[model samples]
Target: MSYIETTMKKLQRSSPGQPEFYQATEEILQSLRPLIDKHPQYLQQNIIERMVEPERQIMFRVVWHDDEGKVHVNKGYRVQFSSTLGPYKGGIRFHPSVNASTIKFLGFEQIFKNALTGLSLGGGKGGSDFDPKNRSEQEIMRFCQAFMTELHRHIGATVDVPAGDIGVGKREIGYMFGQYKRLNGNFEGVLTGKGLNWGGSLVRSEATGYGLVYFTENMLQAHDDSLDGKRCLVSGAGNVAIHTIEKLYQLGALPVSCSDSTGTLYHEKGIDLILVRELKEQRRSSLIDYLESHSDAKFTPIDQYPKDGHAVWRIKADAAFPCATQNELTLADAKALSENGINCIVEGANMPCTADAQAHIIATGMHYGPAKAANAGGVATSQLEMAQNASMIQWSFTEVDKRLQEIMKDIYQRCSETAIEFHQPCNLAFGANIAGFRKVADAMLEQGLV
Candidate 1:
């Protein structure tokens, strides 16, 4: 058998039927196919299989009292995937879409993303299927407290530090942190996305989105290009999307599209970040609000984004940043992008692109980066927040932001160098996979099959 097929067969043999974890590993492995011939050591150890599987998977039932005086039970999970380099560090997402498969995929990706940060953090992730979409504040608080009541036992500051994801924002984090404090009776940096009034960092909210832009900037520079005068499309209206829009504006790029779960709004001029922040944060309104405010913009239903019920890749642009959930883009979308002449894509959300879409991006010879490497700014800043909490000090926005830039640059260098070393130039997925995989694998080797 060929080396690639053999390696994949070995991984399947070792790990068994784990579709999500397998998908995460296959992308990295495909990129690293060339490495098998030179460094047979990687194949000998079945590193792909070893790293694809989590160290531990915790699934529990979170029973809570709703504001209506009724008890509701929801399934919760915390996938502590790896701790090879350091403690398990990742975010806790709370959305109805979360499941075992979803968490497994996220946790597996976290291992490499954390390693790419150049920090002493391993990879892990946790969350639940309890959707906080329209829940009352008190309802969310009770849920968070109940979730933490059980979760506090499995995590700690130096063990597993989870920040915020999808529906787990500052409010959710505050409730969880308070519950942890009440249960444990000790104050520590168990959570990374805490309020600044407590122990949060200055740029924590902006880190992921801004960090995405930073990575894109570096990629563009390598191509002898820049973000200046580039028209772009960004999905999602959350923190990452908003901050990414702000950063895009700051760097003179026009972000023309943004969306919520309900719909997508596109303005030929550009999206107004201030209005978007207000709509999402204050009113919790949809993208239609922007169109209502400005006559120049157009609002379309979510599924109708491409006008023919196809993906929106046909929309011409210099860059595409998918900041929404996973598998948002399909193979048709990738083909549309290829036909339309897209320049590059950088994921702001974890696994935002399908395997086919990713292949299309690479097949076009466009600059592409995976979420683990491209969207690592948040975790890098989370580690910084941990340091601040440990030292009992806070840093200015400028100070934290400077450090964030340096970390992103360093991550870029890691991916770039690893790709070049393996004679696979510009293949960031391979570089990131190998660079991150080697670090954790070595650590696991040192710790010995536990």
Candidate 2:
């Protein structure tokens, strides 16, 4: 059997029922075939085998008390996939959908994403099946403390640092950090996405969204196009999607849509950035509330989405940003977008597109950006936060944002150049997987077998 085939079968057996993790591994392994063929040394050393298996897999039960004095139990996971380049780094998500398979997939993708940033960071991901929506403040705080009580032992500033994702945000981070501080009795940079007054770097929250746009702009410019005056569809109303819409407006693009768990919202003229931020970031309300302000906007409930596709992709637009969640977009969605003349599709979330959907996007000549490379802004800025914390000095917002832009540009240049080198010019996803793998693989080779 082929090396890729053999490795995949083994992974399937070892990680049974983890379709998401297997899908992520298969994607990277398939892309790495070219690089592997060029470097037989990697095979000889069994690098692929070592790289797929995580250095550590942490599974813990978090028991917390809610407002009504009810006990709750949730599964928590921390998959420290690799530390070949530097310290283990990734985000801590809090959502009902979080599971070992999801975390594993996210952690595996992190290895390549962190590598693409040209930063001294490794790959890891942790989360729980705890849903933060509609929970009382007291309940949320207690849950954060309970979760941190167990998690604090596994992480450290220089060993494994985690930021926030999805349901886990500043509120949750604040609670967790406070608990860690009370428990450890020492102030350290063990986490990113901290509050402004507390060790957190500026522009960190907005980094991922802005970085997505920056990368998208870079790709468009490379193809002699730009986002100026384009109608864009952005999925998700979280930090990534909200910030993506914000930056799109700043770049003169009309972002027409943003969605959440409830439904998708589309404003044909343009999305009101301020209102979205208010509803999602502040009010914690649903996208359905948007129609109260913009009476003309359209709201499509989740059930009302096309049977074969998604609501967000059905809208006619020049570009699409899938910033929602894993496998949210299917091949039918890609086809629908292509039919509507949407060409530029940049992933703002980890593994947002299914394997087949991603293939269709590339096959139809769309300017596609994979999640590992395109959605790397959040982690990149987290590293910057780590640097600021380690140095005991915080840079100005403009300074931090300038660094973010430069990093995004470098990532684009590297991915693009590597794609050209491999004779698949503009295939950024393939280039990204190859470039990221080579960096980590080479480092692992030099560091010797662990």
Candidate 3:
């Protein structure tokens, strides 16, 4: 291995907690490997080590009374990754999978994602290991009340803002926001993704998914191509995947397949957006239920894709968006995508591709868009929600969507220009790392060894 590779491998193994954090840092460091010689301070200041670790990691116990009058306890966490640019801002996830390692990696990724948005919000993530699935409304409310009881002290409108993530949706946000209001006794924008009647922005829900398509559209245009006739595969049946499909349809692209944790469904013609929305949002049922409703669509377990590789990456598509989870796409999958002539990849989920998978794409000269740059649309629109809340105004969908598109285009340009300036054209990971890192690093320099 080369010196840069050896350096990154050494640093990666020295860290503690989730393997995902090391996976994420190794991807960024590999991309930025060429820059260390010129910017020796990156090594001297130990920015790789400092940046890979969260500034503060808070874990606490949440105890609350259930509707059954039973007291239950759950683990909660808030990882403040970086506060270089401004106050901490990220979403709070409530899922069975949430833990310190998961939160740490997420918070670490948020630093760059927030910076890429050109917003003055630093990076942080908070959440609990409480799964809301299949729970009664009262039970969810009780849990949210309990979760916020402990989380309320650490967040504020100007301090750290938390929004919806994964298992935390509008209902969860409403409960938490109400608790925050009750505790603070003032109407402050401490949380986003609230109901429109409250203070939520018009396009916040669709921002991340739609923004992924918008960024992908720009990348395609740069290559003298478009999404018009491309066969698209999007993983995940959640909010992000659903809306990403919607926007892809709007832009004349045919999204053919989507998956849930259970299985993947492929429609040879195209996925019906209305039916999909009803099945996912209204019914909150399985993707399998959609298959039962539509006999024409084919349902296959995640492992059943025809190719001998990861199902999501093995599919023959003009484009692929992995909206599922971290490290979902493995290195072998990356090699399959390269062999299949996959045109472009845009991450709709945080750190969806493993470090080796990312390196495979970079080595193959494929168009790769990192999560920090591609997924900034979510936080960018979240910041817009904060602005709307502060001003007591709600923008129309067209106006908000137009701004989202503009921000995505701006992100594309910034990454592109940075890549070119660094003599690594089309290397978006490098562009994003350097571009986002410079902003936060400069802020840290100004703050002076805090």
Candidate 4:
């Protein structure tokens, strides 16, 4: 068997029943075939083998009390995938769907994402099956405290720093940081995505969304096009999706849709940022609530979605941003988007597109931005937060935003140039994997076998 096939078979055998992890591994390894062929030293040194396995895997149980004095327990995980480049860096998610496989997939993707940022950071991912939705503030705080009680031992400022993801937002980060401070008795940068009043850097919350747009803009510029006056479709109503819409408006693009687990909200005229923030961020409500105020807007439930594709992708638009969860954009969804005239697709979520979906999009000649390169802005900003904390200084929003834009531009250039070097011009997914892998692989080689 070939080296890539051999590695994938071993991974599948070792991590059985982890479809997400398997998919992520296959996607990255398949893309690295070109690099492996060019550099036989990597094979001789068994670099790919070591890179596939995480440096550490942590699993723990968290117990907390609800407002009614009921005891609750949940499973938590932390996969420190790699630290060859720098400290273990990623996010801590709190959601019902979080599992070891999910965390592994996220951590693996993070390795490449952090590398593309051109920053001294590594890759890691941690989370729990604890759902923050519908929980009282007191319950959420108690859960955060309990989760941190265990997670604090595995993470540190310079060793392994984690930020926020999905259900773990500013509120979740604040609670966890408070607990860590009380337990460890030191206020270090053990975590990113903190509240602005604390060590959190400015524009950190909007970094991922804004960065997605910046990368997309760069791609358009390279193709002699622009986001100006473009009709866009954005999935997910969370931080990434909201910020993506915000940046799209700033660039004069009309974003027409945002969704939640329940359904998608489509506004033909363009989404209302104020109402969306009030419903999602403030009230913690669903997109269906959005229609209560704007009767003109349409809400399509997941059950009512098309048999073969997602409702969001079926919407005719110039661009589509899959800011939702993994495997959200299926091959059928890709076909639907192509049929609907989507000219560009930039992933705002990790592994949002399935392999077949991504291939289909690329085969159709659409400009595609993979998650690792396109969504590095969030982690890049998280590293910036660490820098601000280490220096005991906070930068203005404009300053942080300027740095984020520059970082995204640099990442785009790196991906574009690497693609050309590989003779696969414009194949960003392939370019990203190669560029990110080479840096970390070289670092590992110089460090010697661990």
Over 410-430, each residue of candidate 4 has an lDDT whose tens digit, in order, gives: 999999999999999999998
Per-residue lDDT of model 1, residues 1-450, tens digit only: 766666667766865666666687678767666666766776677665677667888989999887789999999999898888888998999998888778888888999899999899988999999999888999999999999988999999889999999999999999999999999998999999999999999999999999999999998898899999999888888999999999999999999888778877788889888888889999988778787789998777866666433334556788888898888877777777667667788999999888878887877788897899999999999999999999999999999999999999889989999999998789888799889877877777677667
Better of 2 and 3 by TM-score: 2
Global fold similarity of model 1 (TM-score): 0.95
lDDT pick, better of 1 and 2: 2
Residue pairs in collision within model 2: none
* Residue 255, model 3, lDDT: 91
lDDT of 1 at 228: 95
* Residue 101 miss distance in model 1 (angstroms): 0.6
Candidate 2 local lDDT, 143-197, one digit each (tens) = 9999999999999998999999989888899999999999999899999999989
Estimate the TM-score of every prediction: 0.95, 0.99, 0.94, 0.99
What's the lDDT for all of these models?
A: 0.86, 0.94, 0.84, 0.94
lDDT for each residue of candidate 3 in 1-450, tens digit (9 for 90 to 100) = 865576556755665556766666666666676677777776777666677667877889988766678888899999988888877989899888888778877888889889988888899999998988778899999899888988889888988899888898899999999999999897989999999999899989999999999999898788898889888888888889988999999899899888887788888789977887887788877777877768998888866654534576766888889998787888888888877778688899999887778888887888888888998888999999999988999999999999999999989988999999899899888899888877787677667667
Flag clash pairs in model 4: none
- Ten residues in sequence with the least summed lDDT for candidate 2: 306-315
Of the candidates numbered 1 and 3, which has the greater lDDT value?
Answer: 1
Cα-based RMSD of the predictions, in order? 2.1, 0.7, 2.4, 0.8
TM-score of predicted structure 2: 0.99
